[model samples]
Structures are given as C-alpha cells and as structure tokens.
Target: MTAPNLSANLLVELFVEELPPKALKKLGDAFATTLANSLKNAGLAPSTAAVTAYASPRRLAAHVTDVAAVAADKPVVQKLMPVAVGLDATGNATPALLKKLAALGADAAAVASLRRENDGKAEVLFYDSLAKGATLAEGLQKAIEAALAALPIPKVMTYQLADGWSSVNFVRPAHALLALHGNEVVPVSVLGLNSGRQTHGHRFEAAVDPVIIANADSYPETLLRNGSVIASFAERKAEIARQLAAAAAQAGADLKPIEDDALLDEVTALVERPNVLIGQFEEEFLAVPQECLILTMKANQKYFPLLDTAGTLTNKFLVVSNIRPEDASAVIGGNERVVRPRLADAKFFFDQDRKKSLESRLPGLAKVVYHNKLGTQGERVQRVAAIARAIADELGGGELTKQAEQAALLAKADLLTDMVGEFPELQGIMGRYYAQHDGLPAEVADAIEDHYKPRFAGDSLPRSRVGVVVALADKLETLAGMFGIGQIPTGDKDPFALRRHALGVIRMLAENDLALPLDRLLNGVFAQFTGVDGFQANPAALSAFIYERLAGNLREQGYSAQEVDAVVSQQPQRLGDIPKRLAAVRAFSALPEAAALAAANKRVGNILKKIEGTVEARVDPALFVEAAETALHAALVEVVPQADAAFDTGDYTQSLTALAALRAPVDAFFDGVMVNADDPALRANRQGLLAKLHAAMNKVADISRLQ
Candidate 1:
C-alpha cells in the first residue's frame, strides 16, 4: 500500500473515434474500477484517487485525480490450473491424468494447477490483487487498452504504422492518445495513437492537430485557443441553442426549438462549429396547412419552425448546418429547392381533398377493413352512429343529438380520403375542414373534429357533450366488437389500443360529468354483433373485460393500484360508474371515521360473503334478536335512501358521507351480537341485517372492496 499523502495524479484520455453517449459513461466507470481494483487486488491501495468519467459524442475519458506517482507493486493475477476437472476429482487422478496427457500429447512437466487449492480444495477461480509501488504508466495503459479491447469497440479506425493501414471500425477513427502526469506526456499507445502532448480541435473550422496540451487540467481551454473541437456535450448543446436563437432573430421571427431533448442531442452530433442559417418559403405554401409545413421542416428536413410575435406561422425557418458558408445565398437557394417538392405534394393533396365533399366520401370507407374480426371502417361507422343515437337520448337530446349523428356518420369518412389516409393524425381535423367546406353546420363540424380527441393518455377530451357522446360511442363499439370476437387485449399487446380507447371513454365521462351507465351502453354497443360475423357475445365476459380495463384506466389516473382493485372487486358494475364510486371510496377511506365505518361494513360483508344460497341474504326483521342488531338495521334503513340519492345525484362525497352513519351501529352490533346464533332464525336475522349494511355501503361501491 502507498503512503496516505501521495499526490501525483494519472490522467488517461482515449481520444479515439467518437462514442455514443451511453457507451461513454459505461467505459469510464469500467476504466476507473479497473484502475482501482487492479491496484487493490494486489494488496496495494492508493490514497485519495477519484476516477471521473464524462463523455461527448466524440471521446471517452477517465481522469484519476490525486493518484500516486507510481502504482502499488502488488499485481492482481490469475493463476490457472492446466489440468482438467475430470482428471483431478477423486483418488483416480493417476489414471485420469494419463488419459488427459495422452489426449493432448502434452507432457506433465509444464502443466500448472488448473485450479487453486486453498485449504487443500480445488477452486478453478483465480484471485486478483494489486501490489504496492507498481508502475502508474504501465497500469494506466494496460487498463485503458484492456477495457477498450474487451468491450465491443465502436467507431474505430486504423492508421499507417510503418505498414499498410488495415480496416477497423469505430464511431470515428481514434485520432490521438493523450495521457498526462503533471504536464508531462506519458508515452502510451492505444488504437494506433501514441500518447502525445497535444490534440486536435474542430475538424473543418479549426483543423489543428498535435497542439501541445499542458495536462488534463488544461484540456477544455486549450481546445478553444488552438481551434480544436473541445469534447464537451453540454457546451455543444448550449452553442446550438444560442446559434438557433440568433438565427431566429436574424429572420425577424422567434424560432421554436422542438422541445425534445433526445432529438436535439441527435441533431448535435452531425455538426461541429454549428453555423445557423435563416431561410424563408413562399406564403402560398401556407394554404397547404400548418401541419404539412411544420412536419416538412421539423421531421423531414430537421429545420426549426419560426413564428411571428402573435404566435402565427411566419414564412421564415431556421436551420443548423455543420460549417459556415462563405456565400449564404447558395445555401439558402439549395434549401429552398429541396423544400419546393414537399410543398408541391402537400398542395396537391389539399386540392384533391376539397375536390369531393366529405359526405360523398362516406361510401368509399366500405372498401377499408376494420379488422379480420370486426367489419370494415364503413360498418364500424354505422355501429358508432347507432351507439351515438342511444347515448344522445340518455344525455337529454337537443342540438347534441343532431351533432352526435353528424360526427359519427362522417368520422370514418376521412379514412377514405387521400389526404387523411396519408396523415392519420389529421383525421378529425380534416373531417371538420371538409365538412365545413361542404356547408355543414358549425356545431356539427366542431363535434366531428372533437370526436377523435384525447387519442392518448393525458390528451384533451372532447370539447362538447355531443363530441363526448360520439367518441364514447365509437370507442365502446370497438371494445365490445373486439371483445365479442375474442380479440381481447393481452400483456403488452393491446394492438387495437383498446386500453387507450377505454381510458378515453372514462376520461370523457369524468371530465364532462356525464352520468351514463357504462354496462348498459356497452351492452347496446355489442348487441348489434349477435351472431353477425360469426362471433357470439358472452355478456358476462365482455362486461368483466370492460370492468378490468376501467379499473386499469382509473388506476392510471392516480387512484391507488390496490384501491382500484378494491373498488372493482366490490362494485363490479357498469365500467363507467366505478370511477366516480372509486373516488368516493378512496376519499372515504382517507377520512378520520373511514376505517371504523369500513369495519362496520366489513362485519356486514363478512356475514354476507359466507351466505351463498338464495335465502341466506334475504332480510327478515322478524328474526332480529339483539338490540344492537336492531339498531344497526334501523340505521342502515335510513342510510340506504341517502346513499342512493347521493349516487343518483353523482354526489360521491354525499354517498360516502351517508355510509359513515352505519359505523357506530355496525361496530356496536358486531361487539354485542353473535352473527352465528344457536337458533337458525336468529342467525338468519343477523345475516339479513349484515346484507342491509352491505347494501347501504354499496350504493356507491363494494364495501368489501374498499379495505
């Protein structure tokens, strides 16, 4: 072990081909451990050494600060047992040894122990250690080289070394090896680059190499001074952002950087000394829709979209190119030329979409298949329309009924249009545009557009009640039809995105305060599929499927996973009702008197749970024995109407509040009364009271489920 006061640090930088960000951190950790462990395993430990690994798109480096001038001498080594295991086991070694000797035709003289025998037992494993006063330069080189060669090398290159340059692979060719100890270059070689006192900077902007580096401490500053590309990921990112903002100002607009960090990081890689360029397109392309233009720039060409002060799309755009252009006019011209064809295609699609009314396209959807189990998009639209009509009646029809019908009929029509088929995301939006173009009512157009909303979790819900009803109707049919045909979602495989559709339905109802029963609507949606398409409906199975999904949807909305499970278990009713009930139950559970109330409910549930026969749960007040049982029965009688009214009014807090009334009576009854009495009538009377208690708590949800 070295003295505790050693101070010379060993800094090894592998300026090899560029590396992926993920690999850089891993290589650094591995290098540091290898440096420390290689020394530690040899019974040698250095004082105050830290291996810090940071990466850019280009290089992987490990810097050990406060390392000893020399490595600890003790070395970690692997001693091998040359003999085979089959020969070494048992006392029959003589015969087994002879066989192995003859098989390899190798003499026994040089055959080392194939395993180490600590305490006279065989161990094929080797013990590695570090020795004190070892060579720092040797250990650093070996560690860096071994770690590099061990992992699947990336972005590799070869160089001429007094011979022909051979083909090697890396993110980039290893440029130079720079290992330093206190401003002195440590002579080492890796990936064909010998350790040097200098390094290169920016490739095109400042292609300086062999620029002397004082030490690892001076790396960042030296690169900037010598016109070299400094290996700094954060620095590169900030520079890109700065250049992008400046270019936006130059173009007389505020540029909106796509807020995806991963995308930004990827764009950073293809540049060095980024030169931001501002360009503009013809205002006529604006007729092609903002989506088309933005996508054409951001997704297709990696250009940034720019907007005016009022957040309106300006004709201007910003782009980051790798190097500066002497004549920016040529660059601007080239970008404009490349964008013209995309704009032309967009304009052509826009013209084609308006050629025929969206209503005229409704019949064209018949050719498209929904799925092998489900009917075509045309048939699905019909199902949506039917369900929409039913939901409208339930919601108290007005303009909503007509709006719902309009949206449902034209919803899938866009799937038949060339423009929407090319851009599935623009389905509802395009449908609304086309409907308006066809002189449809504004309200109807709004519903049509809003129907496809909340497509993903946390996405906005349908804006109008008509839109909400139509969307629910659409999703319900998919869920029901798919379930009827046995195309139910499985682990990680909701290929139909049934989970999303189901969640969307729940969100729509909850957000809009719609009180429609989930089970009834589900039944209505699937009833059209009875014996049609050769798929039979199992009502229980389909209802249960929806319940599970509803529970999953609620759980996704921050309800406890266990709480969701508890509610579904107790109230397994309509899929839509449970979310409201669960909120009530969860809120009730968190209250001061909740556990006591739940305990009373549990007493009621536990008795009812055991009574399976038709007569077991039937109430008969005539058989009531104890005062506590009678008191609890009377308490539940009062709570039932209040609970029902609360549920009826969608006042979840009120429903849960009324149920808490039975807590005292329930607890008193359980404390004083015996549920299983010696007389059958007395016991039956107690069970009946318990059933009533269960009913009181269950106005909103299954009381048994809450706990």
Candidate 2:
C-alpha cells in the first residue's frame, strides 16, 4: 500500500461556557481521541498522526498533524449474488440484478465489467468499485459531531441559539467553533456555530477580543501570547504544580503542597492563567484535627494546604489565582477571608461532636438505616459485634475479644456525630478521636479507627490483632448481609462494594496468616442473621464469591492461572495457606519428575471420577499381579508417610517435593497396569493404589492442573 501525500496540520476548537470542572480533563481527552480515531478510520488522517488535546474551563480543542485534505479512495469488493440468480438461463440481466446494480450507482452498461468467481457452493457475481474519498470539510464536521457525542459529559444543557427557536444540547452552551487546516479555514458547523478562525480568550485578561489562530500548529502559541490563556490542560497543571512548589520553597525550607491530582486538575480547569499566591488563616483553627481543616480547605476552597517536614498541616495554604496582578496581596487576602468561614464551620462541627461521647451516640444509630433489607445501623452494629467476638475467640479469646467487641460497637456510632455527618470520609477517623476523648481503651480506640483499613487496593492492613478481628468481622458481615438479601454484585454494578469487601477479607486473612477457617468465619457471620426477616443466607454461594475474588487477586499478583487453579480447585478452608500451596506448585513445577507425576495424577483422577461407588485408598500388595503396580505400591509405601508428615507440619513445599520420587514408578504403572483387569479383586486393588497415589500427590494442591 502507498501512503497519501497531501497533508497538513489541522486544528479544531469548541469555545463554550465553563465546563464541569471535575470532568473537564476526561471530556478533553475523549474529544481529541474519538475525533482522531474517526478521522483515521475515515482515511482523512494517517494512523500515525500526532494528536494534541487542549482544555481550559471554557474550551476543548485538538490539534492533529499530518491530516489529509481529502481521504484516499478505498477499493471495495462487494459480493452480489449467485450467477444463476443474477442472470437467467439465457444469460440476460434479471430484474433483481438490475435493481442491485442500480442501488450501487451502476447500470446495465457496467455489467460486462463485473467479475465472476466460485463462492464455495456456487459461482457468484462480485462488484468492484472505488468509494469516493471524504473532503476535509465533510470529514471535520463528522469528527466534531462524533467527538461531542463521545465526550464523558456529566450532564447536557439544552439552550436556544441566536435564532431564538432552534436549540442544541451540549455539555455547556457553545459560543464559538473554530477549524483550521494549515493556514486555510475548513468550513464546518456544530452546536449552531459556524467554523472560523476566531475564538474568545481569557474572560478578563486577554490582549485581544478574539484570538485569530493563523494555522493549526500555532493554536497553543497564539492563545498564550494574544489570548493570555494556557490552552493545554497538562501544561497548565504542570505550571501550577511548579509554582506551588516554588511558593512552598520560598515560604519555608520544609514546606510542601498537599499532593492531590484531582485537586490540581480541578484548579487547573478553573484557571487559564495560574498565579500562585500564599494565604494564611488564624493558627487557632489548627486546634481542630488537621484532617478537618485540610478537607475544608481542599473541598470547599480548592486550596492546597501546606504541610511541614513532619507532615503537620500548617496555617498557611496556597491559592491558584486566574489573574497575575502587580500586587498579589488582594488575591491572597481575599482567599484568606473566604476560607475563614469554612474553617470556622469545620471547627464548630468538631467542637460540637466532641461534646458528646461516641458511646452516648450509639442509641441514635437506630434512626439511621444501613440498608433497606438489613435493618437499622444499631442492629447492624450488634451483628458486627457478635461476629467480631466469635472471630476473636477463634484467634485467641480474652482481652482481644473485649477490645474487638467494644470497637465494633462504637464503629458506627460516629455516623451520628456532627463532624462525621458533615464529612463522611472521616467516619472511622472521627470515631477514633471521640473514643480516645471518652477515655476508652487505647486499643479499642485504635481498633475503631483501623476497622476500615485496607479500604482499597494496596491500602494498609490493620496493625492490631483486635483491629484485624473487627475489620474481618465488619467486611464479612457486610458480605453475608448483602448476599443474604440477594443484593449480590453482578457484572460491573456493585452498589454496596461487595467485591471490595471480599478482597478486604481476603487480604486480612492471607496477609495476616490468621488461623481462622474461611468457611467457619462465613458460617459464623451467616449464623448471626438467623432470626432477621428477609434474610436468605447462602453460605456456599458467599464462599464461592470470595474464592472467585481470591483467584482474581492471585492472578493479579503474578501467580499463573494454572497454579492458582491447582491450589484453589481444592477449595482450601484456610485462605492464608493458599500462598504456600502456590509456592509449592511453583517449586514442584521446576522438578524433573513434575510433568509425569502431574499427568499420572490427572489420569488417576479421571479414572476415579468414573467409578460407580466409593474407591478406598487401601492397597493390598498381594493383589498387585503386575510388576509396575508392585513397584508403584512400594514407592507409595516409602514416600506417602514422609509427604504426609511434611504436609501435616505445614511444609507444603517439602510435601510436594517428596512426591517427586514417585514419577518413575507412576509412569511405568500407568503404561503397564490396566486398571480394568479381568478379575474384580485385582481391578479393585489397582484402583485403590491409584487413589492412594492421587491423594498423596494432591496433599498440597491438585497437581493435575499442572498437566
């Protein structure tokens, strides 16, 4: 294939009202990517074309290099119909063929040029033609429409255009549309706006009323110089980050901006020209928890709270202003004034919440519904406390059970607190603080806070044994309750985050190596909801769901699917032992005898599965008539005891390694021995020997999966 030669850089922009700040970056990315993909598919741009996306608060734009003025003509080969159908026995054109030809813009005169070939079953007529290339003007219009339709807009606004009657829907009200190819204007229209070289600059600081982009390559430079707008989202965000660091350095040696990508992106969308200004509030607000002050500043004011070397929140914060005035004092002072009320509200909530003990707030929880089917938070707390106590008993009953019960009881009490009600993200955090203030045990307070640990992937696990117990109980209770009510997760829709809860339980069990059996733990949680109405608990199904999550997580952690399948197929009761089994599988896989033993094990399993009744693992040596069977029996007698001892001691790697000695005898036996012997006694004995070998081989994992 030859490449198209005529190409030029293309620019397209949609100037509109302020876009949704949180979705600005996504919209901009989708706009550029979808448009570029469409143009490439349409042959109007090379697949290798470089695409650059730009987004500010009021505009979304894209610049593509090496876009064709017109797409290359594409050759099309379309199958018509069978020759017998298209032409009669007399070989004259039929009405069907004529109609088909007419639909393709061809007439009878073109029939002589049609190609005929056998299409497997019969001779078929094929039409060969060239599809016309799309002009740049037409292609740009389609690209723009597709890009707009593909944007991840949170919502659409429908507004009347200047025509007064006609209306268009977009993420925001579109005011201008610009399209340029090289130095020429490409005529296209969208959202009731005609494409031109003109677009508005910054609302207050532009040097010109309309920035006239000369060419596609000059869009960013023109906007920066004449429009006083940094057009690129990435460049603007980087600039803000740089300025924030510089400002922090100027303020103190150890100061740094609170690192948050979402906040930075939102602030970037809010400004075209970023001016970093340092602002300060009264240090008295620091008396409140740093998290409250930090959340208020970042969430309400979009300010980056500065932190010291010890990661302590300072009274100073940085503001990203849209304008760069000679004196930044007004901007700084205004930001400081605007933040005072928000900080005071946080302080008030904190103070009011501390007035009452978290224990006293427990009764109020009955007013808050946990789930429609799951009863009130007060009832949910009781269930969690019960589960925690059971788990603590399994781990090591005593002070641990007491602390876990206390923590689980107070865990949901914070939901009624003023601070947590105002900031739900601080649910467990506020609980810890209030528990400490109420003179609760330190471990109890810590457990209350850490119950929600490892909230997401790669998050930390609970540090205390009581915390671990409580966390496991809490997550298991959620799973049991949700699944019991048939609110199970399906596909991508998990309203209750059941997948996350399952993974949390898996992490706690595996990472902590807790001796608790998974089935028993699940059954314990399920047993707690016995008398609750509308509760249809399925312990087996919930266990399956957890195992599924564990399998996926193991795959993500770099374990091969075969190894995971081998270990997980057994449905081991202890999730903590799965890692050891997987490790044993890996070690076994490297041994020279692993392949033959795995294949033999698979064969034995298949043979045993077909048996009508129970096949015991008792081998009487006198019944073994074949030499290979006798050798296999001897090998088992020598190896099974050692492997069993290793397995019993939790040395799975050694257990699996010990079975390597059976490869030679097992292979010879499979090759020589016929399990379906003429005598019933001989057949039964051989089957029994194979069962014993299978049992020994799979003590750690189902080695058949290795096959």
Candidate 3:
C-alpha cells in the first residue's frame, strides 16, 4: 500500500507482558513525548501535530495526527576551511579543499560556486545544499529506538527473543510491535519484532485473538470494539473512579471508597478492562484499628476500603477487576475471600499487640538501636522525655509537664508491637491505640501519637498542648543529635530527614504560638546528649539550620524574601513572634518614609560595625553639636518610648509605625552631620545616638533588612 501524504495520522503500539503498575503511566507519557519530539525534530511531523498517549496493562501506544509520509527537503550549510587556506596562492582549489569537499559529498566542480564570507577573523568558504528529508519509515525506526532508550523503567527483564539466540531487554517481555501510517504498515522493527497493524488486547475477553487496527485514526475504537480494552490510561482511571463511586453509592449514600490518587493510578495500571466490584469481609475484622485494616487491604490486595461518613473503615470494599462477567458474584466472592486472610492477620497483630501494655513494651525498645552513634531507642526515649518535660515546664509547670513526660516515654513503644513492626507507617498511630488500651489518659495517648506531628509538609500540628510539647521535644532531640554528630544534611542528601525535622519544629513553635525559645530548646536537647561519646553540641549551627527552614517555610507561605529575612535574621528566640515581625516589616515597607529610614539604618549599622568596641546606646546631650543631631535625638526621645510600649504589648505594627516619624530627622542628621567627627568623643556620642535609633527601629524586626 502506498503511504498517504501529510494528511494521515500515525499509530504505534508496543504490546508486551504486564508493565510495572506504578510506572506504566510515566512510561507511556515519556514514550509518546519522546517519539513525537523526535519526529518533529526530524521534520516528519508538524510542530502543531496532535499527540495522544495510550497505556494499558498489556500495551503502550501513541497516535499522532498531521504526520507526514516523507518530510520536506531543507537547505543545509557547511563551513569549509578559511578562504586563504582553501584557495591556492593563485586562488585555485587546493588538495585540502577538494578532500574536504569530497568528504561532504561535493566535488571540485562545485568549488567555483563556493561562497566566501568573513567569519570575524578570516574569510571562510560556505557550502550550501538541499538535504533530502527522512521518510516516515526511516524516521519511525529511529524515533522508536530513541523513545525506548529514554523510558524510565524501574527495572528491566532480559529474555530470549523468538530467534532463541537473540536476547532483548525491556520493562517486560514484548509480544508484538505495531506501527501504522494511515492504513499502511510502516516497516519499523524493534526488539527482534517487525511492525504490523495487529495487536492483542484483553487476553480473555477479546472477540479476536489478534485485533486488527483498521487505520491510524480508528485504533482506539477498534481496540475497544473487538479487543474489549480501554486504550487510554487516564480514560481507564476515570472509568474506574466512576465505577467505584457508583458501586459505593449502590451500597449506601454515605458509603464512599477511600480516595488515593496513587492507589487509583496503580489499579488503573493493573487492569486493561476494569469492572468495579463490591466485596466485603466479616465484620469481626472491624475490631482491628481501621488504619491497620485499610493498610492491609490496600497494600496486599490493592482493594479500596470503603469508609463511612465518619471516616471509619467499613467491612465493605471496592475491587477493580480486569474482567466483566454477566454474573459478577463469583469475582466479588473471590476478592472478598482473598482479602479476608489479610484482614485476619491484621486483627491478630492488633489483638496480640494489645495483650501487652505499652509500658511493658518499653523495655523492648532498649534492644532496638535508634542510631549507631545515638544509642538505643530506649535512650532516645529518655532524652525525649527530659526535653519534653523541660519544654512543658517552660510553657507551664503543672500537669502539662507530667503528661508530656509520660507521652514521650511511650511514643516509641509501638515500634516493638507486631502491628507496627509489620506496618512502620502506623508507628505513631498504633502507639496511640496501644496507649489508650493500656488505660493511659486521653491526653497522653494522643500525645504518644502526635509526637510525630507535622511529619510532612502541610501535615497538621498536634491537637493538644501536651501533643505540641512532646512534638517539639521529639523534633528538637532529632535535630540536635543529628547536628551534634556532624550528620548534617548536605544538598539533596538528607537521609535522616533532618530538614523535615527542622521544619516540624519551626511549624509547631510558630504555628502553635508556643512561648518556648528556640535557642533554649536547642540547648535543652543538646544537654540531654551530654554523656554520649563522640557527641558534640553545636546549638548555634543547629539553630541556624532551623532558622533557615523557618525562613524557607515563611517565604513559601507567600511572604516576600525581604519580610522573611527581616524577621528571620534577628534569630528571634521565640518563633511565635515571627509572623508579627514579618507583618510589621511588610507594613513599614509601604510607607513613603520607610526607604530613607531603612537606608539610614543600614548606614548607621555599617558605621557601628566598623568600630572595634560595642557602641552602647548611652548618648550625651551635651555632645550634640549639630542642630540635625539634636533634632534626631529629640525625635528618638519621643518615638522610642511609644515604639517600646507598643512592642512590649505585642503591637508590632504600631511599633514599626512609630519609627516612621523619625525618618525625616534621621535623614536630616545623616545629610547634615558627619558622625566621624575630628573629635573622638563627638564620634562616639554620635555612634551612641545612632545605636539608640537602631535599637528602637529594630524592636519589631531589623528594618535595615528592608533596604
């Protein structure tokens, strides 16, 4: 069959064994993009060509419209040697020029028509020709090879081809390769397989063994009609979601399948033709914690457990089966049977874990090494308890400290439980369950779970004051211990998740509006590691690391970098004050006088930094020689108290606003007075006055940072 011109579309499919469910969509997208890009780059497809990617369990495919059978030829340019070297002394073609021309498929006869242009330093000969474009067959072959090479295959299988002697490596063993331009089969071969217009679909349900693709444009419809498969990954996923919702609604209006994009993507990859089925297990399995039941069902069986309106896991679940039968009871029954054992195991682990009180499991932690240099989990627990108590005492000294200490002691006890051992993601969650079963107070039980609060970005903070205190202490201990042992995170290599830990601490302190000082918390955590060998406290460095995380977090929250820097650069002891400080700086920045004042503050800071000794804010009125200096001192006398009073009461916006009144006098002083006077006493007095001004303006935030 003769290939059609640019009007016809192209279809390419690689039918194979089941691909990695998690990686199938990515592979499909990459394949289509890479292939389309290669074709476009080779001039075989227009830049506006429409590309559609398809992925099913057994196949990956792409259909591109507006593709060409053969690309249009284009001009080509070659930079030959410089003119002086190409031509002889008599301007004849030299041997070097002829040989170079010959290498480029040109001959001596073409030299007379060669064009010369100055290439900056020398005149160079240029050869121009119309280069023949690649045909569809040639471009398709190269594009397929390039696309396969660029796939992000998590793992590859090496298997013998049909020839038995040849082997091919791919994500899965390939069964067929299909390529078509219009109705014509494009002659492209890969992995020992030649291109054809036939591919298999739905191993069990297909009407035909080898589904024949009618044309490039009708592939999806033909596959669905004859092969019983949905070719598009997104379409299949959406269909699954729709079916799941329908099934859930059929059971009850309040019943809904758990929503997880990752699980949906994975299930979409596992099936070629999805049939949503409802399944159920014995209600006795509901005795297990819902998290454990949900985890087992989702992780082991790829089932979507249903949740009630209260978000409590129900005995019912949804299964996305690859087959659709007239009677789905058999399929539903089989899935129910398959998930029962997993639920039973979860129940067993939960029952066995509850038999022993959480406190009884505490001793088992001593056998579990938390870190090589940091000693056992038991020791870490003790340190965390001490830090928690100290922080709680600072927050308030009564029952809060007692609950925090209790919660910290039992936080890691769940690590020894069978349920947590099998599912590490449920460590804190299981700890809360076990703690409550052991008759611990609800506050302590919640804290046991919440000590890992704000675990990931956007995660919620602890729900109670006890949870907050313990969470802060836990994160602080981790940051201090890691930084103390010089296990600081560098570049992308934060294996210990120290950056997350730091951000957690920042979030709790700032978001919770805790009264705890960051430096003191760092010191307390470091103090806990005193007797450990090879441990050196670097609270300063750790403090800086935490502040950097806080700055980044604030900036991510839509605060300007200057606003964040102004507040973060002060190294505010109490992180709770940072929001107020940032708000104050932002407000100050909008005032017309703010720029001049900030500049004056920056200048004053630079002058003060140049001196060897500290410039105390102890100024002498008698030494104010310049009228401008006298005016500035008087302005400070009026503004400083108002600013300090507003600052002391947490009215940061008012405090910064008060400083705006000094902008004119400060500018006048800088413009009219020389701080570096001939007399050292006058210079010292002037520096002292400037220091007072700096102290007043920076009470809320370092205004100089705004500059």
Model 2 TM-score?
A: 0.98
Query: So what's the TM-score on candidate 3?
Result: 0.96
Instruction: Give TM-scores for every candidate, taking all chains together and pairing residue i with residue i.
Output: 0.75, 0.98, 0.96
lDDT of each: 0.68, 0.92, 0.91
Task: Compute the lDDT for candidate 1.
Answer: 0.68
Q: Which model scores highest in TM-score?
A: 2
Q: Write the per-residue lDDT of candidate 1 for residues 5-40, one digit (tens) a residue.
A: 354555566665455644554554565566555544
Winner of 1 and 3 under TM-score: 3
Model 3, 1-707: lDDT tens per residue?
A: 54455557899999999999999999999999999999999999889999999999889899998789989999998999999889988989999999999998989999988999998999999999889989999999999999999999999889999877999899999989999898889999998899999899799999997999878889999999999999999999999999999999987899999999999999999998999988888998898889998888888899999999999998899999999999999999888888888888888899898889989888888999999999999999999999999998898779999999999999999999898889999989999998888899999999989988888988999999999999988988888899989999999999989999999888888888888877877887899999999999999999899888888888899998888888888899988888888888889999999998888888888988998888899999998888999999999999999989999899899999999899889889988999889899998899899889888877788788887
Error in Å for residue 121 of model 2? 2.2
The Cα error of candidate 1 at residue 630, in Å, is 2.7
True-structure lDDT of candidate 2: 0.92
Ranking by lDDT: 2, 3, 1
Better of 2 and 3 by lDDT: 2
Better of 1 and 2 by lDDT: 2
- Provide the lDDT at 615 for model 2: 95
Our model 3 lands, by Cα RMSD against the true structure, at 1.9
Off-target runs (Cα >4 Å) in candidate 2 are 1-5, 88-92
